[model samples]
Every structure is written in structure tokens, then in C-alpha cells.
Target chain A: MGVNTEPDVLPEARVIAVAGLGLIGGSLARRLAECGRRVIAWNHRPAPYEQARAAGIECVDDVTDLARAVPDVLVLCTPLKAMPDVLAKLAPVLDSRTVLTDVGSVKGQVRDEVKAAGLNDLYVGAHPMAGNEFSGYAASDPSLYDDALWAVTFDECTSYDRLLVVIDMICEGVGDRIIAIDDDTHDQAAALISHMPHVVSTALANELAETPSRNIAQALAAGCWRDMTRVALTDPDRTRAMVEEDAANVAQLLHHMSDRLESMATLLESGDDEALAQVRDFFAVARPYREYKARERGGAAHESVTVRIGGDEASWRDQLLASAKRGEHIMHMTDRTHAIAEIRTALV
Target chain B: MGVNTEPDVLPEARVIAVAGLGLIGGSLARRLAECGRRVIAWNHRPAPYEQARAAGIECVDDVTDLARAVPDVLVLCTPLKAMPDVLAKLAPVLDSRTVLTDVGSVKGQVRDEVKAAGLNDLYVGAHPMAGNEFSGYAASDPSLYDDALWAVTFDECTSYDRLLVVIDMICEGVGDRIIAIDDDTHDQAAALISHMPHVVSTALANELAETPSRNIAQALAAGCWRDMTRVALTDPDRTRAMVEEDAANVAQLLHHMSDRLESMATLLESGDDEALAQVRDFFAVARPYREYKARERGGAAHESVTVRIGGDEASWRDQLLASAKRGEHIMHMTDRTHAIAEIRTALV
Candidate 1:
């Protein structure tokens, strides 16, 4: 309950502007509106306008109209490829009070685009860990954002006050959780978890495709192979774009995974007592993860805790990043100085 | 319809002995009885005996009791670790009229064990692509084998008549499909499609577990990461045993996968036009597989065909292996000379 000089800190995001109402934006806009926050949306196409309107989302034609509305937070829900043009359009019209954000998979790329557009002062990068194989406005559902964990990213130039505003929009307005982290950490983690795995899956599919007895191999393929290669079935163009956007991180992870596989191969080939023991070690290396998943299957419980943010800029940011690294998801802020988080990602 | 020279071919396995009443064996026992075949079963434990009787399956107290019954085909369904012991007990009492078979995952190793027990002459190697996560008779269901594809493996010493007996048990008694190939080919394909992928999944899980910001990466994980790592969450002890049994093939495939990943990593780091082209080619290399899956998803039809099996021993075995390599699943024996197979594993 220590709210003082930062009166604008999470002053309850009342009006929200959503530009580019695809599946993610459409779902976000609908949920925010359903949660009682006034929503103004604009899409590249008018196809979703009728249904969005029926769901109580007001639609506009021009992208700049969303900026002109001067909502508390204006989220650019366009694809990463379309971000530059959208940011270009909103550069002059976006009100200073409207904290800019996005639902892009990569944060650093989007932040750089925002900075290039001279809107870095009003920017807060975000990525919602929510989506299905299906996309477009028609496939969007308000519940898509239900209980979702979002990465709310920042950098040296990010305003603490603006971040609090976006935090309020996520935790309170959108009824979801957030982890406030730096842009680089968010991108690296995203690549580690998603992008690198996509490339691995693709490589597996390639292996099967290239095998001489492919038909025989495919015939004998079961749950393990099927599950590991499922993501390789996704649209390659889209996957390629996502990987290329975060090349360095994905490449680094690919190298690490290559080394692990090669090392395992060597041990399997050795056939000696020591090699066998090392093979045992290779599988045992993921013991922590296996235990965590087993506990998750057993419906492990989460503990809730509160985080205090009352210090200089660097220390405050460091505290938040540390909380995020510990896997504490900010559910909501009790006041500008305190945030309630749930310890759901605990490995042990 | 050439039946004169090989009268034992397609003679049919009316009475069956199942050694081990765990999930795979128990389900097979029940399914055979339900399909009107006399089913005799034995287990190291007697927990499933009473229940087995109720299901019309004759449960024997001792493993030797199974051989004493002189069933038409005796299936050693126990774990690989228990194979030698079970085989030794059956060796002396087993009837020469009985064709020996087992539903082991790896065929070459099992055949070696059977040879060591002096029962290789009667042995027929079989592996059903079935079973869920559950084990034990209580978790077994008759429908566990519904429409399953089984690999019916052989070697230089594999008698054609004994192979036919096992084929009769699988195709008619158990109502499944079969693909007869050499033991080495089966092991190679199994390693390619299943064992290697399991290790790769485990490697990915290890990466996540060892990450400094593991909690953060886990939080960001979605369907791609979850699916790719699903098998890694399997019991490590069991996974290690399976990998060790098929070490050479798995090791070779792991080496190939590592090379693919490392190549991609180099291209990703290069970031030049030529490097990007190579990166695109890396993803494009899987085009054959992606297209195959796309066709599979579209409910591609399987055309019926009859494969002839008559010639000198080596040529006939080669013909069958070629048929399996073409993904033809033998549905039933049309006669001593031909088999009805469905062209199901069509990759293109």
C-alpha cells in the first residue's frame, strides 16, 4: 500500500487500443472488452468487423485511428513483418500517454523497430504464450488469453511508470499473469524453448525423409517419433521467418543440442563398461526435468508470494528480473510498490 | 496356390502359449481367446491368473507348464531381461510341432538369446506396434492391438514354416498386419524411427533442465516444446534399457542428426545470402516428409495388392524384405504362394 510519487503507476488501464485484429489481437480485444475495459480495434481487413462488433469491440478502418483514440495502452498486434509499417503509421498520431506494446513472439526485434520509429519512450514489449495451430479473427476466442503467462519485456530506455501501466493491463485488465524481463532475456528464452525445438523437429523430419528404408521406418514409427516431429508439420515459411528473426539465439541453441546428440552418439558407439555408464548418465542428466514433469502430472500445488519494488531504477529492474528467472509470475499488483506472484514454475 | 512343397505354410496357429501376462502378453492372450483361439498363458507372478481364467485364457502356474501344453505356437512375451530364463525353462519340454515366437521390440537380440537357448530353429521374431503407457494384466485391454502394424522379423536360419505360423497368429488370431523383414533391417528401422528420437527428446529436456533460467524457459514452453519433449518424460531406466539394446543403430542415427543440427547452426551463424539459401535448403530437405504427412492427414487411400512368396530361400526372403521396404503390410495369407497386403506406408 505504498503508492506515492508514481500516481500514474498502474492507474488502471481503462481504454485499450488494438491495431491488427487477427487471432491474437481479436482474442485480446474481446477479452479486454469482456473484462469491462473499453476496447477500440483496427484490422488490416474488414472481415472480422461484424463479429468483433457483435462481441462489443468497436472497429475502425485506418490504423492511425487506434492511435488517435489515445487509449491508455495501444497494442500493435500485427505480424513481425508488418510491424515497421504499422509503427511508421502510428509514429505521429500515437498519444504520449498511450503506452505502446505488442504480442510478437520476439521482443528485442519489435523494440528495435519501435525505437527506430522514435516511439521507444512509450514502448513496452510483450509476448503472450497463447495460440493454436489455427489463426485469423474467426478462430479467436476470448478464453485464449485465460490464465496465460505473458512476457512483459523492457530495456534501459523503458519507463517504469509505462511498464506498470502495461502490467495493469495484463494482470488486471486482461485477467492473466506476467513476468517483467529484459528484451534480450525474453528473446533468448523464447528461442531456447520454442524456436530451437522447431528447428530440431524439422531436422528429424528431414532424417526420416532421407532414410533409404523410409517407408519401413515410417511404418514402425510410434508415439515418440510422432510427438517429436509434430511441429515440423507447421508451415515452413512461417517457421523460417520466426527462426530468422531470432537467428543468433536459435543458432547457439542448435549448436548446444548438436553437441549433446553427438556426445550421446559417441557413448552409444563405445560399447565398453565406461561408455555404458556414460550412456546411463546421459539419460539421467535430465533428472530434474523428469521429476518436475512427474510432479506436474500429479497436480503439484503452487505457492503465492508478493514482490516489493521500491529502489533505484537498476536495482528495481534487477529485482524484477530475478523474480522472473525464479519463475514467479506476477498475477497482479496490490499497489505501485508491491506485486503478488505465484510460484508455479518451481522445478524442485 | 502352390501348397505341395510347403504344406506347413498357412497351416494356422489354433492353440497359443503366452509366456508373461503383462500388458502386451495379457492383451494378446485375451484377444486370441476372444477371436476363438485356445490361449494358454504363464507369468512370473500369479496375480493375473484368476482374471485370465475369467477371460477364457488358461493360466499356468509354471513357465514349464506352457511348454507341456504343446500349443501350436509358443510366444515368449516376457521382458528381454527375462528372455534367457524363460527360454531355458521351455527348451527341453517344448514340442517340435510348436513354432516359437515372441513380441520383443528388438528382434536380432531376441533371436540371439533364442539361439543361446538352442530354440532358434523354432523361433519366429515378432514385434507389435502397440501398447499404452500402462503395464501389467490389469491395465491390459483386448483392443490395445486394434489395427496395429507388426514387424515379423527373420534371419538366415528362420524356417519359412515357423515364420508362417507366427504370421497366422498375428494376422488371423490377433487380427493385425505384418511386415516380414530381416532382423537387422527391423532393428535399424526401429532405431531410426523410435530409439534415436527418444534420445533426442531426452537431450532437449536436459538442455531445458540445465538452463540457468530454466524456470523462465519452462514458463515460455508451449505445444512445440511439450510435444518434442514428451517422450523425454518417460521413465529414464526403461528408456535407457531400450536404447542400450539397440545401441549401434541409434548411435549412427544420432550422429546423422547431430550433423544436420550442426550444419544448420553454422548456416544460422553465417547470416549471408548464400548461408540463408543453405538454411532454406536445410528446411526444404524435409519437403518429402512434410508432403508425405500432409497426404497422410488428407486421409490417403491404401490400395490392395497380393505379393507372391515362392522361390529359393534367399530370393523369397529378399522379395519379402523389398515388399516391407515398400510399406506393404501383409493383411492375410491368400495361399502358400501369395499374401494380401495393403499399400499403407506410401511416403510419396
Candidate 2:
């Protein structure tokens, strides 16, 4: 076989290694430490080390020190672009006992980097659905992860035991919900929700920037415009990088979005009886989404269910993926055989 | 002449008439009453009459009675589609002493309706930039008008005296800011800021509804997605009506937006160094807006200025429009010849 998947046993995670103490990394390390996990953290810059140690997190000078410590779980909280270099550094010192994972926004490329670094056997993937517009260690807060949901991703060569350890870190340690799926699914879903929308928001702000009567238009702007363009105000370099990293998926979604807007323009420009009827239909197609939001706003509690994973080792992944597709979030693992989940975001 | 421009010495508005007790109308009537004006109101259904009267507003049986009272200003608070019928009802009874204005979202259409109803001479269009997701008198809030800016639109035959009376209602009676401009400019600015952005937001929601992995995608959604899609969850019928009212402007903007998104997709799909550079440029185009928003977040005081209106009656309108184009909100009128404005939304 081209890859190894021999390992099948990992102990419950009590110690976690966090690499790179940025906003996401710093918050996660602080949270894990607060959960009573021995969080060992390293930052490229030692600026946050003192504060991190004061939070009861152990500080390390080099990332290799994290690998040498051989914690139950090692989370690479470094930015996506920093993945390869950090992965390369950890490849030699990282013990097989440590299950590797990351909190990168994009999963497919991060997985490719892990494979390239010859650390695929130990790597699982994670992305916590938490953040504000703010960034850096100074903006990091343990409460950022409050009631957060995460996507735990895998691939063909992914170790089940490693996946279990990552799930332990997320569900038991971080006190969050998760959906286990493959890397490609994670990337595409992320593009649809986050990456592609960032491009659209930027396009909007760019259009306003080019408008001759921008100031007058902006004066008339209300909550709608503010909410729509809020993401565009984030660091452009960072947004560009995120969009570029998920290039193909974002491009595909953009094309779909472009077509949607073009067709709408045509319908509006026509301004005939039939076109007007079509425009109404254009708004109608989103009725399901609108209704879903209505229910969400109604504060209806999501119904909880138990999912029993069955079939072969391969089919267990499929079963969980299918459950996620049905809008279920695995809240906790009861055992190797079953997981408890909540139906959180289903649309009719 | 097609329209009349007579009566140059209209009195300050101490008496106000409000038609329709829906969200916008009810909120406005309550606010005017609280400001200690003699507020008379009419609604098609008297459902809100009890509550409105309790709030110190005078309830009327018919809209014509509002006109018969000869209030200093008669503010039509009905929805745009109801404008024609309401205007037709008030046309014969509306006293010449009453300056006419409507709080419609679209100005061009309302002006046309007023002209058709033979009430153009009495009309001075006004639209308050205030509302919430909820509707009806139940959700009517006096604080809705708190620090609100209004667009007071004019036309070729718009009476200068009538404009001053309407300005009195908005400034002194309602305690708000105003920007006096022509109908088409007001319509276009509203389209640029509100109507067109509503279409874009709905399109985003529609796109998400159609995505195969929608639930999975939505699971990954956080603040950016939530804020961007919030407006789409509002009543689609209302959104559709607003978009249709400004079809031409909204269509043109959608085309520009579509092109922007498509070009970014092409640059991303190319995935070369030059293409990447272009992608960076795409994000960079919005830097001015970013900096503007940053400065706004810093909460620096907006520099205030006094604009002197001169060069004949026609040129007075031009002077105020020019001030508005420079991102000024006319806070209070110092005199007929001078207005005090704040530099609130300048882009560069």
C-alpha cells in the first residue's frame, strides 16, 4: 500500500500541544488549559508566552519541543501558510503516540501538506466555527469557543484511532460539537459559507468604492449594507489568502453566484409581466431558506438523536458523513459504537 | 406650465397628519406626538388607533379628514403600492395650506403618482432611513427616529415655501437631519445603498438554499455568513417590492456586481503569479472603504461646516445637493440662506 494505517489505538487525550499562538491558537490553548488539559504552547514570536504561561499553559521556545513532549494530542494552530514549515519541523521529532491535527480554515491543502511532510499517519483535521473580525493574541479570548461547532475531517489513509483522539480533544476537551467528514467535503462547505461570501462582500465594497456618488449612497446605508460589507472590512491580505487557498471551490461558487446575479439583472431589466413574474419566482426559490431562518429565530431547540456507526471501518466514516449531510452535529461520543448528535441546521 | 410653484412664505409646521399606522407611519406619528406636535393619524384598519391615541396621537376615521384638518404638513406613511389610492383620496380635500410629503422608500415613483393625482404642487418627498424587521403598530417605536437622517427630495416644480415647511417638520418637529436633493438622485442613492444590496443579499440566500451540501455549509457558517444573510431572512415580498420600485438602478448595479464576481473567479481559476497579483488587486480596490470604515470605528468627531445657499432659487437646491455629495448631513437650518451640516460619510 502507498500509505500506512496500522495504528488503531489512542488513549483519551489529557495533554494537548498547540503550535503558533495567534488569535485562534492562543484562544484554543487558553480554553484547553481551562478545561484542565495540560496545554503546551509555542509561538514563532515569544510575545504571548508569558500571558499563556500565566493562564496555566506550559510555554515552549521551539515547536520541536512540543513534538518532543509527545502529548496525547498536538494541534497545529498556525495559519494555513505556516502549515508546511511547521509540519516539516515536527515530522522528525513527533512521536507516533501523539495524534496530530490542525485548526486550519482549509482542509484539503493542509492534508496535502501533511502527506508531503510524511506525517499523514498521525494527522486529522479540525476547524472551529468561531471568530470575530479581530485578530492576534491580544484579541484572543477563551469565550470565542463558546458553543462552537467544529468539522473533523479525514481521508482514505486517516487512522480511526487518531480521529478518535481529535474527537476527544474537540468534544470532551473543548466542549464543542463536531461533524466528521472527509477533507474535500470540508473545503467545499467552507467555501460556500465563508470563503466565497468574503469575495462577494469585497466585490460589494469595491463597487461602492468605484461609485461616483458613493458618499451620498453610503449616507443612505442602513443595517443591511453594514451587515453585508462587514467581512470586507477585515484585512484584505488575509481574506485574499483564505480565498486563494480554497481557489477551485471559491471560483466555482463565484461562477454560480455571478450567474445568479446576471440572471436577476436580466429579469429586472426586462420589466415585463412575464419577467416580473419570474422575478417573484427568483425571490421565491429562497423561501425554504427564509422559513428555515424564521424557525431558527423562533428559538426552537434542535432535536437530539443517537447515531450508531456500523458496517466496516470504511463505512463508519460514510455513516457519520451521511449523518452530517442530514444536518446533524455529533455532540458527544458514547463509545466506539455510537455517537449523540443534534439536528441543528436542516432546510426543507 | 405642467405644474404650479406658488406661495413663498409657508409657516413652520406645528401640526402634522400621518396616514397609515404601519411600522414606519406609526413610529413617525408617535415620535411627532412625543416631540409635542399636534399629531393626527389615519389607518385603513383602526387596529392601532387605541394604542396610537394612548401615545398622544389624534386618530382620524378617513385619510381625507387628515387633509380637511389642514395640518401644516400631511405625511403619507402608507406603503408605496398604496400611494396612488391614498393620494387620489386626498387630492380634492387636501388644503393648499398643507405641505404634502410621503415616507416612501422610492422617490421617483411616488413623485410620478403625486403628479398623476394632481397633488404635485403640494408635494415635498421625504423618506426616513429607519425601520426594523417587524411591522405594524405593535412594533412601532419612537426611538426609531432617534438621530435619523432623512432624504427630502425636490423636483422642477417643487415649491420653495413648501420645501421649507416640510424641512420644518423634519428638522424642528421631528428632531432629525435632512439632505435635500432631486427625485432621481434620491432614487439612485437609495438603490445604490438599500435596494440593490437587498437583491444581492437575497441572491446569496437563494444560492445557499440550492447548494447540495447546504446544511454542512451552514454548519460552518459564523458571524460573516450570519450578518450577510440576515436581510435575506426578512419578508421577501417586501424586498421584492423595494427592488422592483428601483428596477433600473438595481439591475445596473447587479450587472456591475456580477462582472466583479466573475472576473475574480477567472483570476482565481487561472492560478498563476500574474493571476494571483490580479486577485490581490481585486481585494486592494476596497482599501479606501476599509480605511474609511476604520476611521469611523475610531469614532473621531466629524468636522461640521456651514453651507451658504445662493445664486437664485434654482442654485440653492444645487448648493445643498453639492454639500450632500461631499458626505454632509444637514443637521439644522441656520436660516433660509444657510444650513449647518456635518461631514459624516466621506469616502476619501
Candidate 3:
């Protein structure tokens, strides 16, 4: 994850084509337009085009015509399913100097789609981890990206100059916490956390529906139940598509989560106090990590780099072998007890 | 379950001995003191008694003075297991007219213990469904009980004259939404809604603790995760006690929940869109129940009789069954809805 190394501020793009005028597209357009960039908005349906135009935004109905405008940047804000076709529509008219990116949930497939559409040289897969329960232009807010993660998925063939430019744009919308993650890692990790949790919450709420005791359940559910099931109220078809499209990775995560739950159930059933104690200890250990993330929201924490490893035996061994690989080199490092340990190498 | 019946408000008692000066006890004492009743605070530990005394409240460290003080009401405000021993201590010198009630989470066990102690005629089982994440006397706020359910568990052979007094006391401490329920239904319903969800949330938080990608998971977790897992930080011993004592009922609920989740997983694995749509519809149907409950949280909403059922049957069935049964018929009439093809009957 790229957090350190001074931010590369690129000059503003002259003309930007946003391929979908929904939540992401509208928000991005509003922000960029406010910052004095000419944003050309496009939507499949004609409804959003008017809204975009009414807001003093440039609107284009045809992808080819929009592409023919030869904007300095092309931001594909369409849904995952529509991304490939959108790319294909613009591929023939694309300029080599134009930088391309998207605001999709999953990065792996988008990366593949970019390659298959022969736009690898132009496109940099950017997944801004920002959204609301609501979708569409009316619901969009420019501040939606204010202090959120914008994961710029990168591979060896990705243009470093274009990646930096996209990063600069993302940082402008959100804060300067631009993460550089491999496409696979970002997608798989997202599947484990965001995608799977949504499905679980929806399932729980769905199960309680039409049940005899649902009224009492509703009465008893405090802040906890509300938070746990809020995601259930979001559009199911959109979430379903994301999960099904990344079925294999999502399935793996589901299996892992299920196993964890099963173990917990076993401990509860057997009255295993020791196991329960261990679980409690785990929560205590994880508390700092959770608090760290909570605090990291709305602001950048540090200028430090995070190293990523693939999901393999080498990854496990690397975790053990890589001492302070988290951007910190040698120097006085604090141990678990908060005592400083002297190291020979220079610190990052 | 008791619904719309007029609560027999008891006359103000001369002296009330609160047998646990913790959050609920402290809050109750403050309310009673405010209502011009002299409350004798007793705590097994001396610290809270001192804290209570500092607030201009009378405190007692000894249990033997129950006979000497001869309070009209003896409130057992300890945990469920402690109730029996406290009752036994109070029994030796208890007055015949002395009414006893408890502030325990689980009602069925407390009812059984009160019966076994031969205090059935004098004992009333009460559960004020209100709380905060924090505990102890310092954390107590009298208004915490404002507009909350004060469920009074009763059965055959209970003195009607004494029941009114208990109901009035609860109404004064909390708002007058006094619900009369049987011990079995209270326990079972509570297991379904309160206890089971707490267990589920805690288990989920614990599951996430062990993941190598917990940092990523935590970062990706938005308002939904924070809201959902708020209950995961519950005091471990209290959680253990709840599940352990009510293991049978809680286990059944867990089984039901597990089955639901497993079925959902199966549906996802099979890629069944029709089943998924049905699941979504179920959640939509269940939305009104939660909304109604949310509406009733504050205001004159509490003045109306709210008859809530513990099972999955529609709201109409709950009303019909409550009306059809003898225990339910005696309750007062308030707001109403109709069940399918059910014969309409007036509340007695």
C-alpha cells in the first residue's frame, strides 16, 4: 500500500468524460467541475444527462462522441457489468496520452476487462471505497469522497506517470491516503470484508422477516442490531452481481467465516470457558487494530508504506521473516511492552 | 401476554429496600427518592453504598436490618443467581405484607426461585427493558427508564391487590407501559431477540479477530460494521452468565439462526436468484415492525397499549391469539390490527 513517498501532484486534466452519471459519477463530476475542470457526463438513460446539463455540466449521450472529444482523462463510473462494453465503445477513439480509470467495487475483473478491451495502456484500475445506501444523481454528494480510501490497483504493465496522475485526482477528491494494491489482493480482501458482510446482514434481516417473534426482536434490538442489518436495506441486485461475479473469492471468504462461527458455536455449546477466554483475549488484541482504523478515517495517519504478499505458503513465511517490513527500517523500535529496541539499520 | 388492561397503581410505600445499588438499583432509588419515597440502599460491596450515600441517600451494609426497618417493598436488584440467596436472607425477618420484586434479565428462573422461597404471594417478577453499555452507580441516570417497557411476569394465585402496587411502582420508575407476561414466554421471547443477537454479534467480532486481513477488514468496515458490532464489547462474564443460565432457550434460538444462515449460504452457492428475491421480499415485509418499534421509543406513543408477540407470526396472529386466550383477553384494548379471516373479539 502506497502511503509514503511525497504526493505527486499532477496538473489538472483539461477535459474529463465520466461514463455514468450515478452516485460516483455525479459526485466526481460535481467535485471536478467545482475545481474548474470541464467534466463531460454520460448516462445510459437520458434522465441523468439533463440533470448534469442543468447543473452547468457538459453532457454527452454517445460514448463514441464523448471519446472523440479526446479528454485528458476518462473516468468510467459505470456499474461493473457495464464496464467492459463502455470500454469497448470508447477504445477505438481513445487517445494514447489520455489517462483512464474507473470507480468500480471490484478491481480484478476491471483490470482484466481493460486488458481485453485493449485499453491497458490507458486505463488504471481505481476502486474508490466510497458509497451510500442510496444510488443515483440526486443522492450524490461531492463530499462522499472526503477522507475515504481510493485503491489504485497496479500491475507491472501499468503506466507509472498515468497512475500518479490518477492518484493526484483521487487524493483531491478524498484525502491523500491513496493506496497502491495489487488487483487480486484488493478484490479478494474486499470480498472478505465488505461484500460478504453485506450478504450476511441482509440474510439475518431476511430470516427475521415474517417470523413469529419479529416484533419482539425489533423491540429488543438496540443500536447493535440496527448497525448489523443496515446493509440489508441496500439494493440486493447490485450486491448480488458483485458477489456472483467474484463467486470464487467470495466463496472462499464465506467458508473461512463459516468455520470461525462454527468453532465459536462449538465452544458455546460445550461450555468451554477456556476457549471463550481465548476468544475474548483475541478481541482485546484486535481492539487496537480496530481503533487504529477508526481513527484513520477522515484523515491520513502516517506517511508509511505497507508491503503486500500473495496468498501462499511464502506469504506466511514472509510474514514471519519480514521484521518491520511495514516501511519502518532499523532504529529504536518499540517492542510489545513499549520498551525501545535498538536496531542497526536506518529507519524509514 | 398482558396488553391493554388498566395497571393497578399501588399507593406510595413508606420504605423500600433496594438490594443492589448498581445502575438499575441506583436509577430506581433516584426515581423513588424523587417521588418522595425513602429508599434504604443495600449493597454486598461497600463501594457503591458509599457512592449512593454521598448522593444524600441512606445506605445499609448489613442484611439483618430487613426485619428492623420493615420496609413495605423489598426490591431484589441483583443478578439472577444472587436473587435466591438475597431472598433467603430477607425471608427470616420479612413482613407478610412486604412486596418483593427483582430487576434480573431472566424472569423465569427468578419466578421459580421466588416460588421455591415461598414468597410467591408477595413476589412480583419485573424486567425493565432498558440499559446502557456502561454499568455501576456512577453510570446511573434516572431518565434512562423513560418510555421503556416494564414487563411484569405473573401467574395464577397472585394477589390482585398487590399487583396494582407493583405496577404503579414500575410506572413511576419507568414510563407506564406495563406489560404482563408469563415467565416462559418472557424467557423464550427474550432468547429470540435479545440474548441470541448479542451472542451472534459477539461471535462475529471474535471471528474477525483471528483473520490475518483484520486490518483490511477493519479499514473497509464503514458505519455498518461499527453499528452492527457495538454489542460485541459487552462484559464477558455477564454474557457468559446469560447464555449459561438460559442455555436451553438460547441454544434453540442459535440453532434457528444458524439454520437460516446456512440456508442462505446454500442459496448463494447454488446461485438461486429467485430464492434471493424471495429473501429480499421477506426483509421488506419485516421493515414495518422495526419502524413501529422505533416510533414508540419516545413520546405519547407509550400511552397506548402495545401488544407485541415473540414469534414469527404476523402482527394480526399475535393479536388474535392474545385475544383468544384467557390471559390475553383480560388485558386492555388499545391500537389494533386484523389477522386473516380471524373472528374479531373485544378486549374484556
Sort by DockQ, best first.
Answer: 1, 2, 3
- List, in order, the clash count of every candidate structure: 0, 0, 13
For each candidate, the alpha-carbon lDDT, in order, equals 0.89, 0.87, 0.62
Q: List iRMS (one decimal) for every candidate.
A: 0.9, 0.9, 6.2
Instruction: Report the lDDT tens digits of candidate 1 across residue range A207-256.
Output: 88888889999999999888888888888989998999999999999999
Answer with 2 or 3, whichever has the higher DockQ: 2
In DockQ, how does model 1 score against the reference complex? 0.84
Residue pairs clashing, model 1 = none
In Å, residue A65's CA in model 2 sits off its true spot by 2.3
Using lDDT, give the best candidate's number: 1
Candidate with the greatest TM-score versus the true structure: 1
DockQ of 3: 0.26
Show model 3 residue runs off by greater than 4 Å.
A1-15, A35-38, A44-58, A109-121, A155-161, A172-175, A235-246, A272-348, B1-15, B45-58, B80-85, B112-121, B155-162, B172-174, B272-348
lDDT for each residue of candidate 2 in A216-269, tens digit (9 for 90 to 100): 888899898899999999889988889989999999999999999999999999
| Candidate with the larger TM-score of 1 and 2 | 1
Q: What does candidate 3's lDDT look like per residue over A1-348, in tens digits?
A: 111224333334567778888998898888778777677878888787766776667987687777777776789998887887888888888877678888887887888899999999787787776777778998988888776666666675775556655655665433434445567666766766667666667656655564554544444455656667777665566666776667656666556555555554556667667966754553464454444445445454454333332223334224312322232211111221111211211112
| Pairs that clash in candidate 2 | none
DockQ for every prediction shown: 0.84, 0.81, 0.26
Q: Which candidate has the highest DockQ of all?
A: 1
